[model samples]
Target: MNNTSVEKNLANKTVFPILFAISFSHLLNDTIQSLIPAIYPVIKHTFSLSFSQIGLITLVFQLSSSLLQPFVGLYTDKKPQPYSLALGMSFTLTGLVLLSLSANYHMMLLSVALVGLGSSIFHPEASRIAHSASGGKRGLAQSIFQLGGNAGSSLGPLLAAWIIVPYGQFSVIWFSTIALLAIIILTFVGNWYKGMVGVIKKNSHSITAISPFSKRKVVFSVSILLVLIFSKYFYMASLTSYFTFYMIDKFHVSVQSSQFYLFVFLFSVAAGTLIGGPVGDRFGRKYVIWFSILGTAPFALLLPHANLFWTTVLIVPIGVILASAFSAILVYAQELIPGKVGLVAGLFFGFAFGMGGIGSAIMGKLADETSISHVFFLCSFLPLIGLLTGLLPNIEGDRKKIKSNK
Candidate 1:
């Protein structure tokens, strides 16, 4: 009879259509975001930038993107904003235009900060939408959502190699079209979300997950997760922000060839993203978190020492293995604080970005003071931080066992 009635009649089952729609929007949004770093080589050369300056660009961008997400998530958790996703896209569109026209370093920084602002608005609300539509399949929904982002990220380097490099900086203007398309799709999604908001608000209190840990235990576990995120993203920064440079510096690969290598590693990330969520749903998020972060240790340790061919080969497993951790970690955190989905998403995503930004800056400085090879060698030890995952209390196992006994 009404919005609430309409929502109630449909079983709380997964909404595939909406899931796919949001995921596609994610792909579009991240494609635009990835362009900034994708064209780093071009910008670096065009501006006569040092590694520290390059890293500062990323730091500024990431800080803008990361800083607002938690606040946005917290605010939206209290008061949902359906059309904000579209609004975020508008910011991205503006940024894309400015970036294409950027004539100097300051202009580039300003352009990326605008794009980062858009991302700050996008992730939290989008994550909430995915969680709401999940219908108990949180991990799978998150993975599907994440797969699109990773896929889009992988495309950036490849596209930059083809478009930005050949045609020059002006070519970035073309991706403004991608941001525009995302805005349109997000409008449609916004309409659907508008209708669902009433129902979602009513059902919010019932969305509690059963956690077996005490409050102190939950907080401790979350701290462990954050530490794990720092380790993961710190390591990831070396590859994502510097791997292309590393390739050119060490192997004497052409700039275009280096981008192709970056693309391969990123594509592996997209492929591995499918593993964590569904597997976590079946097995346990903790186990997935453990293997995903720690399993990469062997591969990562070998990566910096390998020859060019082997370096490329080793990056695949490193990317794939490390890529699996986030979905598991995010879902696990959501489960930790049952009702604060938005806050958890915001906190985790924001922290990841912050770590990445910080890591890039530090690595850049290290590379400048020493060498890119030294940076890679030092980062190789980061995955070993996964050992702290053992400190995570097995909340999933406890919840299952308690239910079975009852």
Candidate 2:
């Protein structure tokens, strides 16, 4: 059969069972990943680590996660790996064991890198699975997949506060059960993936239709998307890596109280993520992208100036608005590139990780040199870059109309 015919057949088959499986695995995977950041205060106090040291920990973890992802995606694009996800989770299990046993700062960094390595392996291929299972509902599929990670992220601080903070660093070992659960789940996903590959092999030709836009236009559009990602993830780096610190510094809140506030912001992120995909599917992703990123400007600008109560209130909107852009952005990019789903997912995910890492490190240095308040003020302007959303081509109009008609 021709590529178009194969595309149609695949598009008609939305596999919810596999989607939910992968989404659940994603929750387990990210919950493990989020623990690294969530316990920063505990580790900082335990080891008497500096802010730069904390940033370096993120840098190491994120670099390990980011640097290998594109290569893994590229390799897998040519040669699909059905069982790699399960194997990847094993690495995470080992990392968790090591983290619990870590004696000092260096050990913690090494431990996190192993966890990062597992993440690098998991995301690109799992994303391909999501795409395969998407049928025609790419936005909703990506959103469902992302919602798990966001929810898991929201859970980390609370988990840390309840389990790790009260019980101490040794309590990290308790969470290793989550990794084992993911391994078993991913093993099942791998089986489903194996079956799906056979179907693709039987019916589909390698995807090679020329993109509607010229190569130059595609490159320019991707550049704009990457810039938007940088703006989003960099701003996120400030919040994710340092927001707890900011709360403690500015409000004199206790560590546990700061974590609770962090949980609120992250929960809002989960809620926003759930909304972005369906909305993007209904409307044009471009409009959703525009609103998701640029819409946060007012709240983001206000966050730094707010007093304690208002600061708490403001993060809800900030999290919701900023969190919405990613699903739209990922789906938009996939549409632009057509068949390079693995590569595209890898590049965007990797770049997002890289940007977040770099942002954390830079902000860490800035915070050390100046203050956390100054860092927030500087990041408030990052969202203004969203004005460039106007530059994205109007590619989704036909899809939007079709979706509307249905």
Candidate 3:
């Protein structure tokens, strides 16, 4: 019943089945979400949309995705919602159906917004579940969970190329099947989450804990993490929202070919995602964060100047290095504010989305004003902001040492 015993119990209670279930659901959820961006070229051509309009569509989707996550996480921290995951997927299903039927740009926005809302609902609670099942391997758990999303993201363009590009917009309804399967899977996850809540309630007395750092230190650390998120996601916004267009514009590649190229980058991201968490768990998150964020700089700086062959080669390392930071960053923030896992996840995730949205909107306008090539050249410097990593406190290293001593 004591704190030590409770800690041991929680540490030893990592439930891999639940972890895998939640991670699978994450994959399904993100795969559905990525479909929006995947079909952008089709939508642009069909609707005669400007680059600005394209950006606005992303703005709407990203805003809807980002704005509500913190509130959802904060609310659920107080009142856990086991079945919210399934309910969220229903929104995505509806969105996918609506996207297929949409006749106008406005309707497209509405459909994407619905999908974004589903994501807002899904992430916080699912993240909490991952944290609970971490079994003292929080970074690895987060990495597993995130690997699903990155993989899902990689799948989106391939699926779009195969399904939407050739068959046209209405074919999108086929993807609703993905959402349906996610709903069924999430229902099971919800049941497990509900049971976990009951167990937590039974052991509530032994679960009390406090942040190891002072509030000011925690706040400072969280700020630094947010900056890192800003750097990572903003740069990501450029790649995710415009990389295809860049490829097409610069190299005159076919849309399908661009999608394939994008897939290469995103697949690299998935591969890199698997590395950060376990590495952070073993070596310390601060080091992982420093290396992951700053390490991408050389490749990013070189990307805008590279030819088609070299561009293809460079993006792989760029994706791999840059993609590793999020899991480490998220887990570090969670550690800084120990008991507020849901809140930390929501804040960081939401901010990342918000930055991506904002960055997309701005870059869209920039591309409109100048060119996609110029936009990439400008964003090449964003990774240099990773120098701020020097300011982050070294809590993870200290914790690892303590654990080793114990």
Q: What lDDT does each candidate get?
A: 0.91, 0.89, 0.89
In candidate 2 the C-alpha lDDT for residue 48 amounts to: 91
Which residue runs does candidate 3 get wrong by more than 4 Å? 1-11, 201-208, 397-406
Q: Each model's TM-score?
A: 0.97, 0.95, 0.95
Residue 184, candidate 1: Cα error in Å is: 0.5
Per-residue CA lDDT of model 3 for 1-406, tens digit only, reads 9966775586558788888888888888888888888898999999999989999988999899889998999898878899999999999899889999999999999999999999999999899989878777888999999999999998999998998999999998998888999999999988877877755544443554466678898888789889889989989999988999999999999999999999999999999998999999898888999999999999999999999999999999999999899999998888787667778888889899989999999999999999999999999999988898899888856666867998
lDDT of 3 at 293: 91
- Model 1 agreement with the true structure over 1-406: per-residue lDDT tens digits: 9866666654277888888999999999888888888899998989899999989999989899999999999999989899999999999899999999999999999999999999999999999999888888899999999998899989999999999999999999999889989999999999988888878877876555556678899999999999999999999889999999999999999989999999999999999998999999999999999999999999999988899889989989988989999999999998888878888888998999889999999989989999999999999999999999999988777887988998
TM-score of 3: 0.95
lDDT of 2 by residue, 218-328 (tens): 999999999999999999999989999999999899999999999999999988997788899888789989999999999999999999899989999999988889989
Q: Name the best candidate (by lDDT).
A: 1
Write down the lDDT that model 1 would get.
Answer: 0.91
RMSD of 2: 3.1
Q: Per TM-score, what order, best first?
A: 1, 3, 2
> What overall lDDT, based on C-alpha atoms, would model 2 receive against the true structure?
0.89
